[model samples]
Target chain A: MISKEEAAQEAGWIERCQRGEQEAFAPLVERYRSAVFRVVYRVVRRRDEVEDIVQEVFIKAFTAIRSYNFQSSFQTWLSRIALNHCYDYLRRVRASHVTYFWQMSEEGQRNLEATAESREPGGLNAEQRAAVRELASQVLEAAPPADRVLLALKEIEGHSVEEIGEILDLKPSTVKVRLHRARKRLLKEVSSRARVRPGEPAGAPRP
Target chain B: MRCDHVLEILAEGDPRAREIKEHLAQCPACAARARAWRLAQAGFRELASEPVPEASVGFTPRLMRRLAESSRPAPAEQSFFEKVGRRFVYSTLMLALLALLALAVPRSGPLRSPNSAELMLMQPSVATLQDESVLNVDGLGSHWPHNSTVTAPAAGGQR
Candidate 1:
């Protein structure tokens, strides 16, 4: 949580930025670079692309600084911009047919398959751990762009529904409904591929 | 609890997690789904736990350099319809101005109204205008002798 003094100081920087002080923006970027990077990485799941996206998000926020009002906290406003950038990136990547785990190498495929069928995370080595994350990422990538971002924010980034509402500019109730629907669709996708049945244990079949 | 109700509670979380666990113990179908839900949740936790890559050294400096280079706002991309719509508006305004200019200017000089004789001449058919006598009356009335072959004005009118 940001204290009142820090908030006031950040507000000062924003005011300076709004007045065309380019130097004032560096501090804001320094403060939020990790945050923007983490969100972009979680949504897009490409290390090479995260830095470029983070830089672009900051440039956009700086360029459009005049539109920022004090109605919402600076962090929330910045997060909304970051998410919007990530969404656009995801859409373009989806269109290009890249980032689909099925297109990965034989080794990667094996890793994902083995990880998917495993019942527990214990006793997994580093590579297997990475595979677990990759399996989770594939499920998210298969979802629609809006739902993908929401799931990344809620499930992967550990944000609450209310926090998601602020970043997404949606009501908490709306977030819940959309989240519930997204989760259902993903579960159906996973289960149908795996052929999971009542008598059988889950994650037994490879998808 | 129904399978869906139990699953929803499992997936979305609830204060009655104990009840859900009890239901899962009693029901195989719900238990299968419960296993699935747990698996999915575990995957999510693994993803969440992955450490974010640290920004490389000189990230801030590189960004600041890029910012300086791109200080001017990039031109916004317009849709095809937007381009067409903008041109349409410009053309409409140009046409309106032209029409307003046309209305403002006074008509004069060669654009003056024709005399009654010209109006009468214009009213006749081409055949009537082709008549030599009619031409004589309008063109050579005074130059021609009275006794010449040229018909008199009254006779031409009669003709």
Candidate 2:
């Protein structure tokens, strides 16, 4: 949470930027870099793409700083930009036949290697964990971008309906509806693949 | 559980958040669906939480460079319509300003006057207007001498 003093400081930087001080944005970036990266990473899981998207988000925020209304906190406003870029990346990937991939950095590759070996609750084997990750990625890719975005924002990022609505330009009710549908779609996909019936434990064979 | 009931529970997220907890407590199917939904959410959240990447040390500089390039007067960044409209407006304004400038300012020394080229361009138009046919000052267009006592003709004079 940002303190009042911090928010005020942030507002000062934003006002400076809005007044045409382009470098004023650097301080703002320093302040919110981790937050914006975390929120964007929730939507775009590809480690290589995350940094590029984060940079694009800041570039966009800087370009559109003049249009930033102080209605919401700068964090909220920034999140909106990050999420929009994530959706655009998803759409571009969907529309293009050729894949746009970046070679993962050392940190990213190390983390991937680590997660590839990490096991979740229920003590799934390394192969099972990889399958889960692969299946999860596929579900995200298969679901509509909007749905996937709402799912990530709500379930993972824990944004409220109104906040998600503000970020995505949907009404609160629409956010709820969409998120619900997204959850159902993802659940359907997971269950279909795993054949896990209601009340049945995961990995159990279907009758 | 009903489909709407299940979705509402899923949307509620963490059935403990609302009275949905009581409903989930009573309905086994709703509870099962909730667990399933949670597992599904956890599935993706797991991947999302795998690792976060930060912008490199030079990210800000690169982004600022990109921003500057975009905001600078780059035609490729502008839309086709905008490019056409801007070009048209700019060309028209330049011509209009040049024409007005040529007529307003005297044709001073070529080396001294910045608008010398514009004045040169307007010279032909001025000469065309000065033609005897173009400037039909036919009525007593005589130059009256102010040095002498003779007064300039006030009434209409014979051609």
Candidate 3:
């Protein structure tokens, strides 16, 4: 697979693809598949669904490639497709009533607990582990869908704010404000939960 | 400005670091708020960063194969009118250019002759001389061209 930078350097490939040279698009697919997968996986959570969503994102990207102005990085463009697919999937799930928001919240909590249990053998003390688990669950639960998407792209996926803005079709200032708000909300939730729980000391060092 | 600047700078800090430093700061009210916000942020961040289960082992190969299939060339087709329309446009443009050039080029053909009435009408000064002579003479005999034929009429009488 070609590196994204190298694939991007082949400016002629986009033009060729626009001219209906489908073969010219393989390098683009190879370069962006992982990034697209990461975005979809972060939003959808299920491995099987992520695979399907990632494929759909690429297919959509190819079909719409002619309209792409190359104004943003290809990866940014691909991420938008991935994010939109996730949102669509979420909406479908909501409509079907397979899982409501509250149910997902409980599921997320359980997942956090499971993760915390798995992390117990990593030499962390009981109090530290509890704090970590608490913090993780609170952050996940409090973030809105858009904020969750941004957090995934910016923090976990390690995309720059500029890239995130391109993907979300927002200004960098907007992305920054949302990220700050998201972080602030998560912080408040975790700290309040910590104060109420008696097992851990208030000032316990983070694991 | 002081509080705003501090808060602005502090907003960019990692949640854990931000909270610890904010608590140590003198502003108890702001520090408490910052701590709360940071804790909430940390919680959310942790959940968001949870690793996904590894994809099925054959996933990459399958994806690559599908990508390869999608990139394969399909048949190409162009309609008859599409081809004709293109040629028509090209020929029309060429013809227009040729017509314009033909008009622009110098020519050596004979200059077309003028009609007799046109030649006479074009010399108004010549027509005026006849009018001036008629006014000066009381009889037409003075200016008439003759070979012993008709007599001229007097100014006031018919002859």
DockQ of each: 0.20, 0.15, 0.09
For residue A204, what is the lDDT in candidate 3?
Answer: 43
How is the predicted docking of candidate 1 categorized under the CAPRI scheme?
incorrect
lDDT of 3 at A79: 79
Docking class of 2: incorrect
Scored by lDDT, model 2 comes in at 0.66
Model 2 C-alpha lDDT per residue in residues A1-207, reported as the tens digit of each score: 888998888889999999877778888888888898898877777777788788889888988998898987788889888888888888888788434333334543343334322323245445545555665666666777788788778776777889889887779998877777787778776555544445532223336
Chain A accuracy as TM-score for every candidate: 0.82, 0.78, 0.67
Per-residue lDDT of B53-101 in model 2, one digit per residue for the tens? 7777887678777777666654564677688898999999999999998
Chain B TM-score for each model? 0.39, 0.32, 0.31
Give candidate 3 regions above 4 Å deviation: A1-5, A8-13, A21-23, A94-138, A191-207, B1-11, B14-159
TM-score of chain A of 2: 0.78
Q: Cα lDDT of all candidates, in order?
A: 0.73, 0.66, 0.57
Q: B93-139 in candidate 1: lDDT tens per residue? A: 99999998776442321232223234444443323233345444345
The prediction achieving the highest TM-score against the true structure is 1
In angstroms, how far off is A78's CA in candidate 3? 1.0
The better candidate by lDDT, 2 or 3, is: 2
